[model samples]
Target: MKNIKYDFKSVIDRHNTNSLKWDYFDDDIPMWVADMDFKVAPAITESILKRANHPVYGYTVVSDELYDSYINWWNRRYDFKMSREDMLYSIGVMPSISSMIRCLTDIGDEILIQSPVYHVFYYVVEDNNRKVVENELIYENGEYNIDFDDLDEKLSKVKMMILCNPHNPIGKIWSKEELSKIGELCCKHDVILISDEIHCDLTDPDVYYNPFEVSSDYEKAITCLSPSKSFNIAGFQSSIVHTKNSELLEIIKTQLHVDNSDSTNVFATTAVIAAYNESEEWLNQLKDEIFENKQIVKKYLKEELPIIKLVECDSTYLLWLDCSALNVPSKVLSGFLRENQGLFLSAGIDFGKSGDNFLRMNIACPQKLLKEGLGRLKAGITALTIIK
Candidate 1:
């Protein structure tokens, strides 16, 4: 481990802690969920402890400092300037998306999402009684790209489009030209664009994600962001939505308020403030650890398991493994890995139909745990190959 300051090498036990990834399953290695296994930054823990010592855990107000933290962080890190009035707080990104679905589109409206994308994008649209329209990404030569013609055609049918920038599952970071083109297409189709950028901060070291920048004429874009994914503080349930359109912002604020997602918990502000202000060095170290982990997986796959191809990724700790050569469905492969080798991985089918030939593995743990996961993966794949 190159990072001596941050403790990313500790293998902390999370079993029986009401952890969705650990307690909900009996698998020896839980590599399905997106949360990191490493502990949060020292500053974040100290801040939370200080807040916990306070007697009253009552309803808290969103302070100017919280907004300033976000504004300063974005300006410093991404060079993206955000106004205080343009941001709104919510429980999480999905909740904010759900509220936007209710406010912007009517029931039964078609919502567009890029497939082999985040699974929750499907649920938020369908559960709201809206139809899902997929602009399937074109995967060619082991890389993924936007099908602009198809996206343009589909945007005409859908009332809203949810874009996963620095997209999940595949971990592809969309370029600036791509973002500008998407903005242009959405504006042309008069579709409301919701950019889910919760994973923006988890990019490779010195490789930044491009924020969706809309022209002045385009006022239909909304961005949802959070420190939960980067800081491993998802339990706080805090996220913020940003929009340059004043009218749309007011409507969303009302919708979130009605959905009971506007208010923050006592510790939500504390965690966010510390994560943005003080935890940057820890996040930098985390990126280093994740980069090392990716290398470990790459070497293991090349040396021991050549059939399973590791898709190139620039962001996120989730590794997309192309298992099409196995001649087995992703569900079966993932299930076999769990049942036979006690390793849990997310099935690609959960993302979309196009992902059926792939598997998603989370590698945000210590090197010790990562090696164990690789060993289990090799064992499971070898056994499956023998059976076939």
Candidate 2:
């Protein structure tokens, strides 16, 4: 393993494999969904194949090793200690979010979410019969900042709040102090905080994620972490939920049982065990490569498309592009790119109304494809600016 290069550059054809990222769009470059285009680590493939070779795909029981790997990984990377009893398993992170929402809040309760966040957070909030109260992030001078005064006011009324750490779309990694402050407000206001840390392992090279449980106010917080995003095994439908509030944890457990939302496929257990224990080197190399891809985006935006400003991103593979200078709504520009150039990215409006002039690009692919996407983006933006 001394001089061997990890294979993040080779583009794999995912057309016929039922890939959500590839198959969801028709022939266009699919940069919308979060799953990476790179193949998983060799260790993960070996584990899955080894399991496949076994004859019996019987009922699966998650073992203590599964819990241990999760704990060890968090302790090793984030210095957060988690106990086996505090760790719970759910089929998917989004489902777990819904289950917790239904269990913790009564009918017509309000859940807090920051605007211009991951679109799914808004979807689940409304879909679960709850009202969404937005504490929109402050965007000024080309950077996004937490609006503490607004958040404090919002938390005072809501029964629960869902947070995306290393926030999606914006890709801002919240510092320990920032997380503690949020945790403090939630604790003081008798509000429950559910954190989606699924993107924790995908940070840039020197950046790290702070698990919400590390704060003393964590008893009022619940965090969901997944190896699916980092390892690209989202189809496995496996995620871990860590909550320090034992009483609230019991309620979530009961709701999951009632909803039957806690089962993992046969390979999910093995994949998690392999991902946290044996995939550290692969992940480290991935972060460095992603950081390089981000640099390409930054340089391309500055030199080729100076009208669009790239927000400073500290973590996650998402690059938030502010296109207000182009004087076009993001939805219109998004349609133009998809129709004219066959380029598809998450429309900024999908995140929230405040993202009307923005777009989110996924840079977790090979450099060749990254450049290709950039070319399409530049061509599309130039055409739109001319039209305007």
Candidate 3:
């Protein structure tokens, strides 16, 4: 393992802390949720501590320093220049997405999403009384590719399209050309494009994901960004939306403001500023750790459980494992693993029907926990095979 300045191997006990990943299940190992089990950057904790030392916890305002932190981080890292005027603060990416769904589309309007994708894309559209049109990506030879023809056909029927760049579950990073084609199709169809890029900063070490706006000159695009996934400060509930279209921005701002999703909590701003400005090295180290965890899973899967295939991906710590060889549904397999081995991984069917043959495993934990999870997985699968 590479030497790291921060603690990534502590195996901190989260059972009684009201952690969603820990307390929600009786499973001994949870490789389910996207949040990292690693400790946050020292600077983030220090900033929060400094703020908490104050006597009062009151409503907070979004600071210019907070905006600059996001601006500088993007400019330095992705060469994506964003102005403060074009950006709007939100409590989270999902709330802002839900707000956009409510305001931008009419009842029964169709929305496009690529599958298998982040599961919430299904909820936000259907729950809002809008229809979902899936342009399922073509999966071939252990890789995922955009079906431009299908996307073009689907865009003609939808009012809006939600894109998951450096997508979750699959962990694939959409390329520049692919994003350009998507933008062109959306423009041709006059469809609104919402790019969920919260996972933009979690790529493999030295690998970078292309921001949607930077990859395409589509004016109808809204890019949702957050440091929560990258810096593991998700509990802070801070995110922002960037769009170059002033008219669309105004409409979105109004909807978010009306929905109360634009307000910030006391520590969200502090965490964002510290994460973007003072925690670059910590993020770099995290990328390395995730990379190592991926390698560990790959080696273990190949050696001990050749029945399961690890999908090839370049971004996000969430890994999509192909369990097609087991001839079992992902939901049943996931349940069996949890019941028999106390290992909880996400059932891929939750993302989309196309994902029923796969399982999504979150490997953003310490090596010790990752190894234990793998052990449980192997045990569960071995028993399942025996039953078969």
Candidate 4:
């Protein structure tokens, strides 16, 4: 058997290529975007190259083999079975969510979301003229939990609910029992559930992530997933939507027509297949590296910068740093870090009202870069303390 390798020591320059994360600032280390800095798996690269070898690129239909690849992947990795008829392709999860909001609910309807979530969910709801109902997550004992009572109270008039499994920003992996309760609540309320499982594949091996529809109660849910985050293929623009309910699936299909969403890029299709079919070893290595990075951040914060507290995380390379102990506004602290430390992070307020004193850090870079960023952060905080 071949050994796994996750050597992210080599940093490849990504600037000057219209890369949003890298080109956002000059002489700044970007630890903001969710995308990783490591090279894609060799299998994905080989698949893209093989597809590129074709001289002519033309409009194409999704093949049965492509659907089979996704099906096989889900069955093997998550122990969930899906049929081809239940599958649909989209450019990405965000676009799908935006369209689904419009399709599943009418204008002026309410959409429920957990606060301090991925910011895009808020935009998707409000941009579609739907009211956003925020159920702020409860943070205690260094971990985050959903406020189900708040959610149930708010769900009284909600037409749809967006769930972030293995949530973003705080990186809490929702367990099966937790998801079962959510599924039951949604079903009781007769609300359409849009479950985003994009970060499901990047979790630590010890963590457990449950698919929403795996439970009998959540069968009416529409679950979105992709290999983009797992294999560093966000630029490829491909994702899968699974729904067992025919009526809901049809509505989503109709919305696609209304929005003129027809197809995905050819390369993205090939890349997803390769990633799901042949990148397990690489993914395992990447998960280990990410866990190591998480540990390093915890150790550095505890020993070097005890004032900064890390939120409990079990999935994704994103870390939430609580800086309320410093008693500084998050935006002001973010500015200070960017200007003095040359470090870029996603400001906490961007997520929601509950995230004001926190900052989201992306630890998906090489170790050297991670270390340098932490060092600069330590220095910057120490200087701030001295001046104060």
Q: Scored by Cα lDDT, where does model 4 land? A: 0.86
lDDT of 3 by residue, 114-206 (tens): 999999999999999999999998999999988999998989888999999988879998899999989999999999999999999999999
Span of ten consecutive residues with least summed lDDT in model 1 = 210-219
lDDT for 98 in candidate 4 is 90
TM-score, model 3 to reference: 0.99
**In candidate 1, what are the lDDT values of residues 158-276, reduced to their tens digit?**
89999998899999999888888898899999999999999999998999998885323357889999999999999999999999999999999999999999999999899999999
Q: Which candidate is the best by TM-score?
A: 3
Residue pairs with clashing backbones, model 2: none
Output the number of the lDDT-best candidate.
3
Q: Provide TM-scores for the models.
A: 0.98, 0.98, 0.99, 0.97
User: Listing every candidate in turn, what is its Cα RMSD in Å to the true structure after a full C-alpha superposition?
Assistant: 1.6, 1.1, 1.5, 1.3
Write model 2 residue lDDT over 52-142, tens digit each, in one string. Answer: 9999998898789999999999998899899999888899899999999888998899999998999999989999899999999999998
In TM-score terms, candidate 2 sits at 0.98
Give the Cα-based TM-score of candidate 1 against the true structure.
0.98
Candidate 1 Cα misplacement greater than 4 A, ranges: 1-4, 214-217
After TM-score superposition, the amount by which residue 166's alpha carbon in candidate 2 deviates from its true location, in angstroms, is 1.1
Instruction: Judge candidate 3 against the unseen true structure and give its global Cα lDDT, from 0 to 1.
Output: 0.94
> Model 3: which residue pairs collide?
none
Error of 1 at 91 (Å): 0.7
Better of 2 and 3 by TM-score: 3
**Prediction-by-prediction clash tally:** 0, 0, 0, 0
**Poorly placed runs, candidate 4 (over 4 Å):** 4-6
